[model samples]
Target: MRVTVSQPTRRGTRRSHGVRAPAPTVASMTRLLPVLATAAVLLAACTSDAETPASSGCDPALAAWADAGFSGAIAITAGGETVCEEGYGDANTALTVFAIGSVTKAFTAAAIYDLVDSGALVTSDRVGDLLPELRGPVRDATLMQLMTHTSGLNGSAGADHQPLWRADAIAAIGAMPLAFAPGTDHVYSNAAYTLLALVVEEVSDSTYREHAMTRILDGFASAGFWDGAPAAVGPRAVGHLDDGSTGEAGDFAGPHWALDGNGGLAMSMPDLAAWTHALFTGGVVSVESAAAIADPVVDLGDGAAETPGWVARDASAYGEPFLAAAGGGGDVGHDTMVVWIPSEERVVAVASNGGDVSAEELMAAVGPALAAGDPIPAPDAPGGTVDPDVAAAIVGDYRLDTGGAYRVSDDDGLRIAALGADAVEVLFPPRDAAAADAVRTHERAVADLLAGETPAGREELAALEDEFGPVGGAEPAGTIVADGELRTYATLATGDGPLLVWYALDDEGAVSAVEAGAQPPALDLVTDGDAFRPADPAGTGPDVTVSFAAGVLTVTGPDGAVTAQRD
Candidate 1:
């Protein structure tokens, strides 16, 4: 989902376009005796090695989600001590490693800063200067523009799992026209981070992995791009769909195109918490560079600003100051949300492996309360106890992920809506139809929509094929109940891109509404307004998966074919 300063993000449709998740990082610091006295004094403490953080409170929403089938880890650190760290559902609270999605950009930004610190790279240098082979509109985009996501790039040059080799990845990005002139506007472009990763390779004369591990990732024992790690590093969590079943084992061994620099690292929560602490406390980069990395260098307006690694907001936006960032692969179901309250020197983070419960949603439920030091409800407290007065008071307009305008509020959780109406779009509209026809029409509609036949944004959408690549046929991916509708999805493709198309049908076997993308984001629930719940239409449970009753399913793969039926 696209998020702004007014709300939590890195999920919704952006993530719904969902590909990968939030990220992790950490390290110790040696006191720096900078020439300036003030700088030296500040560095003396902020740059000291990390002390173990402390754990303090419990959150009722976390408990609610955990009981609701959310499986993930959370890490919170404050005053150089652990606050609360726990794993929920099937995950090991202390040992499960997760794919930390866009959170990885924090490190990419850090690596760039470290290079700057060492006089190896300059933020003002044009991206093209470092990688001459890059011939896209962003060629002249300064490194600063890239870090701030103002390089005129929009999302990806290809799918999150395309696996294009390095040369091809570079060529793909180089060939795409920038959405606008570099430094002219802002769009969270994952491809830009991949390009930055390439710069890391070119300037450092080493792999992004090698350089990051040695320089920026010095203290992260298990945080690195997903590849083999010693057994002690920890077991990686499998991504689960909103349904309790159908968890996926992630594949991070890669051609770093989709995975690099943007959102490709995996690590345990402790490592992730430590990384944020280290970076913010001056244990990672210099204080000045850390500030640049953590705070906005470019203003995106609407209470949002782009920093090297985060999306920052002043007190006016969130009712308090915070530096926020979130990421997750809609496809993998691995998600993370992080909020650093600079005033309290506290970091609150949530990571989830279940698609049904997004970290963004969970964080919204608890982060603000945790920050305010509000009374913590009992872990067993029912999800319905949020004060109605507070809920009403919280209602307001929001500009969320990708800058979508929203009428939003939170009581149970944040819901986006049209002012005073049920204009919220459904994730999967209701449907009842023959399987063959649904599949056929769904595929055609997707290609046609992305190919620019859709009326509203034809001109703007004309180049989608360049970013996600030309559309191809689709295949059944999964099924889940959404708002009580038996919604279904197909693993759609665009140059082997892992895109998704979800739809619902009417009683007469006609499609009601169909949505497709890497993530159209909260486009699913946002339209529901305050009436929406993280539950089914019956208001009893999440919109999750349901097995067919007395129905048959077919499976055909390279090995053979099989059929299953209700006994």
Candidate 2:
């Protein structure tokens, strides 16, 4: 999502006329020292001498570069201690922090899990049953599918509006339709999660912000959590754009558009680290729920070359590091990477306004530090392909290994399933012959629109749409798999990127699943692995095989004919 602070950004911008100034010395870096120390102790306890961190403060090889480029914040906490805390440039150009784009998903997940913990709701509950206002296929979607992103309400391709005005976002999503049946496949969808926030609001009988503040933010006051949705978060960090400029970090200018479940959270680096610590060490949710969240629910292993951690795609070099147990959020000039280092018994939280580039830098800087027990250099090299052109190039229809269809469309266009709500898009629309034709036509229209489109600040929106489909109302429970857990993969590519729920057993032995989108025809759900050679080379042809390893999936088609892996 493209988020701009109320204050003017750009090299020669100034503060807003009547905004309240940010607090001076909101929180001293020293406050984090104790936390860092505790974390160091914790880390030392968890690792052997070989894995122990270096005693010296590794040179700021990465930090120096970060200081030069973007006005940023850095916090390194291990175990329970805070090892490093610093803020460079301006945390608030006009009393606002950088918007942490999609990092907000972690918070949304936490809040939803709170409701689940309190018996207020369950992930498996159908969207239709709880959030009745939802019509179309979304009505049938389950919260689990939404959380795991397997809800097939919207196909892989749909309209996006993260960087636009809030009304535009709702309007665009409203115009689209679900592209596939719910629980049919995995498609990372911010729109789906944003709608989920609304669902949480309805179920809790309170605003999403209130729910998060009360149950999450407020509950963690001891850990430095603060209350801020539309308002400025205290001790926040500044975000920098690729234009070689920096600005105050905060949510978009639209008042109604606070950090939604899909993305839209603002916080300091220290606070985020604490939040991650709670998540990994059972401070946020119960161990059972945490385990469940981290557990792999389905496999997307067949007919795909490689598996990605978060988004389902074949290539990993271009995408963000997929954290099996962690979550990510970012838009335009804001980003956050929160990782739980279990081997070290610590949580590492890095929030930046440098957009997608931050993911790579954080990984580059911290990955080696954690692995080699050494310090990271400043201004770590940017990761992933951050070019707007590169991101846009991949924006098109992609056939998911799962049974449903997946596509990426321009930012403003809408997508709908056959016979689904004309105004309200769903994960999977009601498939009637008439509606399917219309949906196909809609795809063509969107392509035309994109071809004539200009850089009207919807690039982030386009990326979001490419990342997810339109907001489908309801669907079933689902999850994505990578390897067995959410660890980052460097050299190898294996397993399913995201597992889509395609079939279920019934009383009459009737195999029920969502209708396939525009994918190659397949007969059975079983698959061995991406390599059709079969796990057992001796196995005969017509072998529809499915194998679940570590937590990721790999499927080999019948006769070892076709193979696809979730990226």
Q: What C-alpha lDDT values do all the predictions have? A: 0.54, 0.39
Across residues 1-567, which tens digit of lDDT does each residue of candidate 1 receive? 221112211122223221211110000000000001111112122223432223323333456667654578877677657766778877756558887777788889899998888799989999988997877677898888888878886555555554668888888888766667887766557778888888998999688878878888787786776542321167878786433333335553556566678867778877887888788878888888887787667765555567887777655534555675666644455777666767657675667776444554443343333444453222222234444664465355533232323343463454433211111222222233343344344445543444456431253243334555665645554333332233444554678476655544322122332345522223223222223333321122333221111233222222233233322
Reference-based TM-score, model 1: 0.63
Which regions of candidate 2 fall more than 4 Å away from where they truly are? 1-59, 67-71, 89-98, 153-175, 219-232, 244-259, 298-332, 355-359, 365-567
lDDT for predicted candidate 1 compared with the true structure:
0.54
By lDDT, the best candidate is: 1
Cα lDDT, model 2, residue 461 = 25
RMSD versus native structure for model 2:
18.8
Candidate 2 weakest ten by summed lDDT: 480-489
Per-residue lDDT for 1-567 in model 2, tens only?
111122221221111100000111110100121122222333333234443233322223444444434345555566777665555444422122445445566667777787888898888888678754555666667777877656654311122121343444444444445545777765445556666777678889688777766666654332222223435345455445423245333433433332356544556666766776776566777877665655545454421111111212122332222232222221234544444445554554444455322432334334434444554334422222223553344334332344433233224321111111211122222134443443343333232322324221134224323433432222322211110011000111113122211111111111111111111111112122222111111111123333333323333432232222223
Judged by whole-model lDDT over C-alpha atoms, candidate 2 comes out at 0.39
- Residue 269 lDDT in candidate 1: 78
